[model samples]
Target: MTDKTTSPPPSEEPAGELLLTSPPTFLGSVEGATVEAIAALAREGSVPTILQVPTKGLGPDLPDNVPILWDRHAQKPISLLEEVRAAKPPLERVGTAVVTTLASFIELTNRHKDDGSAIFAKTAWPEPKLTAVIDYHMPGETKTARRGKHRIAYPFPLTDEFKVWVAGHGKTFKQADFAEFMEEHAAELAAPDQYEINTFEPMFKERFGTPAEILDLSRHLEVNVGAKMKSAVRNASGERQMVFETEHTGANGQPIDIPGIFIVSVAPFLAGDAEPEVVRIPARLRYRAAGGEVVWFYQLYRWEFFLRERVQDDLARAAKETSLPAFEGAPEMAA
Candidate 1:
């Protein structure tokens, strides 16, 4: 297999046979050096300057000048991927790769009355002024075949307008704000006094199918419940716990034996800057041991049951306000 060069050697096939075949492909590395060489040739008008992404996809840090054809199977907003795949034949005919991030681009290009003033938020990256082109291989396309490498032919013109959008928009690309958000959440988790578990009493009753009680201890880290399941609760390690009784001195000075059956677990929450008020909480129920220690617990599986109602309502509100951009070639995609 030959690596596509500026001047590919003439094949031994007859001229008429060559006409019947597809254009030859250049297959090799799409690293920074390889892309730069292709760009140089494209600028000189020596060869077509279209790039097709491999099955593995390109690295996140490719230069802006290298417009890429993103594979539909790679990452997601499924609807957008469908739209891109549907538009492939037309896009191939025009010789330009469709480049945009997320499903927001679809909404942006095809604006509707339902989409009001919502702004789609994305972590913008700072790179050269070029729209990141992405595409996948269409059936019957030609490419070079090498060990651990394959090529796809893209014979399209990279227009100036597309370049400008990629360069300008890429600057807004920032990293996801999960780190800071998790830090704040962790701080709240470390200090029990920062939040009142009592406030969640009604929530626990609604979620666990019975009222929950707070166990009297030096530190109120756990909630105790009395719901008896057909099966026993087991912890993550699959350990079973024995039910226990502990002596509790009542207000009247009488010794009371408290029965501890099950232990309640705290749920994990995740928040972002955009929806700081919303949290995803999971619920876990566990069994108590003879030593007044929680040994076995059920998994925290249901997300909706533990999530605060107000947070869920707020997220729904934010969904309505989300908006997308009107890409330069979006209209052509529909055509």
Candidate 2:
């Protein structure tokens, strides 16, 4: 009997109205330019949103208004050993040891050049001065113990050869003084094997003032030995559930599934040693269609490193090599 004004039921509300009433809109994008646009919108007091961009080149220019949502991706290519080996230059069947030794020397010298300060900081060793001396003995025999002793007796006088050595170590030493100092040390510097003597020249100059500084420097300038990190991956759990099994189409318009495994191993720095520790670290991977022309949506995956104790066993062998007095100052933890 009441005048019932017919009203629409709550369920009859429009979807857009329901959406608007439910919550303020939050949007997300991964493209850099798109993120810039969303940030502009946010600055105007619009609804807050999130955008995720590839970690590749996102610089400091990111806006303060927008929040970043990082989604981890599982690292692909489960095995890194083959991949790393394949990446290296082909080794000759003969003279493998010599080649490896030279390669190690070159690598060490280049590393010293690039981050000499960092290396010195870690070791508390003085900066090495590169010098070159004429080698009276032939190349192959120069490394032998007897030859090494003989060379030490007539130590090559430091000369322009030192400058050349520094330059060969890295191109960054253009301004470094090579000849002036050699003339100063000409009286005291004794010849050692060309290779070994040259390697230690920089250390000698750094620790000692002149020829008199060699023995003291030799005591402290131990070769810093450590493993190089090859690759790494972390465990997959918790938040990692997000990147689980999103499909990815391949280059030839085919679908390829990628699994997550972050593997990392140390590169051997010393000779006659087994591999160093293989530790897994956290990592993310991205996948996209491989076609040259058409673009596709990229998929992200997250995974964690699965550490194996066996890797440590392999690293133990290298650890043993460093036990001798010769390697006392090598950058390594006590066994």
Model 1 segments more than 4 A misplaced = 1-89, 92-275, 280-287, 290-302, 306-319, 322-335
Question: Which model scores highest in TM-score?
Answer: 1
Backbone clashes in each candidate structure, one number apiece?
Answer: 23, 28
Residue 57 CA error for candidate 1 (Å)?
29
Please tell me which predicted candidate would have the highest lDDT against the true structure.
1
lDDT of 1 by residue, 86-188 (tens): 8787422223233222233233323321222121221121211112112222225468311211111111222343233223221321111212222222322
Question: Candidate 2: what lDDT?
Answer: 0.26
Write candidate 2's Cα lDDT for 230-253 as tens digits: 111112211111111223333233
Give model 2's TM-score versus the native structure. Answer: 0.16
Q: Least accurate stretch of 10 residues (summed lDDT) in model 1?
A: 146-155
Prediction 1 TM-score vs. true? 0.23
